[model samples]
Target: MSAAAFIRITRPHNAVVAGLTALIGYLIATGTLTPPSLLLAVIVALITAGGNVINDVCDVDIDRINRPDRPIPAGEISLGGARAYAAALFIAGIAIAALTPPLCLAIAVINSSILVAYAVRLKRIPVLGNGAVAYLTASVFLFGGAFAGIEGLVRNLSLAAITFLATIARELLKDAEDVDGDAAGGARTLPMIVGVQRTGIFAFACACGAVVVSLLPSGDWWGLLYLAGIAVVDLVILFGAFRGLRCTTPGCVRESGATSILRMGMFAALAVFAIAAVI
Candidate 1:
């Protein structure tokens, strides 16, 4: 495969962001950086890259319609090549995690397995698929916090909660965007079963839920900086969700850029948490 094809299939931007988010979690929980913390970040990035590659491998058919420009559907990379690359990344991540604490190793194994499962089967199961992806995204923080012990986990719980809810909202909107491709691929996603309008409502509710959670005691405990920063991020997320809700068709939702907006909001929230913890 070409270098660009490898990068495209791996989605290096997202992998890098996931690694940075984990580093932020480590910083928040420990208030100090260490060599092992860097290792954790690397491992998370590798696993995330693996997950993206594997997802593309499994979604080739769906992507052919919804995202024909993607690496696989565009014929930039072969399926066998993508699968081998994904396996290598996953193995590398798990091998590195094995050198860390036992908890981290456990998390790495479980998360890798879940990523594979999500690609192979869970993604066709509607709400369960959304929940799985949400948990996986939120768990990156938890994985970083694992290095610091139970107190670290407790400290990062609110961050995880906000991430989880927002991810659900984004995932649902993505399902809406991919409704046509998913239906053609014989997948019964939420947007297909419950209808696009109701799915949009569900996504809106999840975004609102994330916003509410950002105001809870756990969030306040981080002080006004966090709350203030999150307030701006939450507004963006809410606006995205509102736009999603107003769209009854996949084409409209895609044109609205609801998923992209929510993704940016989530990345901003991670930055907010990092900034609040540092300051």
Candidate 2:
């Protein structure tokens, strides 16, 4: 396989972000940066990349219709080859998790299974598919926390909740964006059920939910600095929501800008979380 094919299939950018996410959890739960934590974070990132590859494999036909430039549809990577690569990555990631601790091992096995199931079948369900993706995104926090012996779990859980809701919002927007491809591929997504404009409204509401979740607990855990940083995060989310509200029905066919804003906001929120822990 060509290096470009492997890179395209893995979506290295997302894998890097996944690594950073695990690193944040490790730092939060461990109370000190450690080499082993970093290593485990890398392993988790690889597993995420593997999941991306499998997703591409399953979406080959849909991608050909909606995303013709993708590796599988573009003829840059074979489905069988991608599957084998994903399996190897899953094994490598699980082995590392297994070596860490029991909790880590359990999480790895469950997450890996869920990844496969999501790509193969669950992704065709209506909002349920989005929920599965949100949960998987949230679990990254727990995965890193498990490595730290479960200390400071409350904080990690809080972060996980924030990530989950935020991810749900983004996933919904994505569903709206891919409605065309989904329809061609026989998916029963929210947009297909309720229409694109309604789906955008739903996505906006979910972002609002994330904002509310972020504000919970008052001053019990976070201080003014955290609140201040979260304000910026909330603003970013609000912008995306506003755009969703303003965009016409046809606009829902491609929510690229709104979706990108949500991703940026998530990264900014993570940064806020990391910074506030120290300040």
Candidate 3:
């Protein structure tokens, strides 16, 4: 494969999201710089990369229709080759986590299973698929804590729940954006079932709810700050959604911009949370 094809298959941009998840775990577990925490970050990134690869392999046909530029769909990489790469990455990720702790290994196994399931079947199941993705997104942070040997899982449950909800909101909105392609592919996403406008509204509500949940006393003022920041971003996204609803064509540029803003805002929040934990 050419260099560009390799990059496309790896989906380097998406790796940031996985790295951020590992960062969350490191912060919650150590609250300070440590070797093990760094290792956990690498492990999480590997796992996330593997998951993305597998997802691409599974969605090659749909991607050929909606995102023909993607590696597998664009014929830059064979589906079989992508599957082999995914399997290797998944095993490597699990091995790395296993070195950290038993709990980390267990979490890794569960995470791998969930990703496989989503790629194989759950991804076509509408809200359930979205929920599963969101749940896994939240689990990244929790899994980080496990790798770091953090005690009292309950202490972080609230934060995890908020993150899960926020991710779910984003996932739903994304589905709404890709409704046309998904419909053609026979995928029953939220927008396919409830219409794009309703899905947009529901996504906005979920984002608002996530912000509210973050405001609850979680003993982390910094986390609250992150939530407040997220709320501001969400408001902007809401306005964009409103515009999309009113416009005849629903500009893809506006929707993409809103999603980018949300992602950046979430990363900012995670950074703040990490800083707060250390201080």
Prediction RMSDs, each to the true structure = 2.8, 2.6, 3.5
lDDT of candidate 3 vs native? 0.70
In terms of TM-score, how similar is model 1 to the real structure? 0.86
Best candidate (score: lDDT) = 1
Model 2 worst lDDT window (10 residues): 247-256
The CA lDDT of each predicted structure is 0.88, 0.80, 0.70
Candidate 2 residue-wise lDDT, 106-223, digit = tens: 9888988999999999987888889999998988888877787766455677678878888888887777777776676677888789887788788888888889888876323487
State, as a TM-score between 0 and 1, how close model 2 is to the true structure: 0.87
TM-score of each: 0.86, 0.87, 0.81
* Model 2: per-residue Cα lDDT at residue 39: 69
> After best superposition, candidate 2 residue 46: deviation in angstroms?
2.2
Question: What would the per-residue lDDT of candidate 1 be over residues 18-134, giving only the tens digit for each residue?
Answer: 888788888877666787689888999999999999999998987898899998888889999899999999999999998888888898999999999999999879899999999
lDDT of 2 at 82: 91
174-218, model 3: which lDDT tens digit per residue? Answer: 776676766667777767667777776776777677666666666
Judging by lDDT, tell me the better candidate of 2 and 3.
Answer: 2
Q: After superposition, how far is residue 254 of candidate 3 from its true place, in Å?
A: 4.7
Error of 3 at 44 (Å): 1.4
List of clashing residue pairs for candidate 3 = none
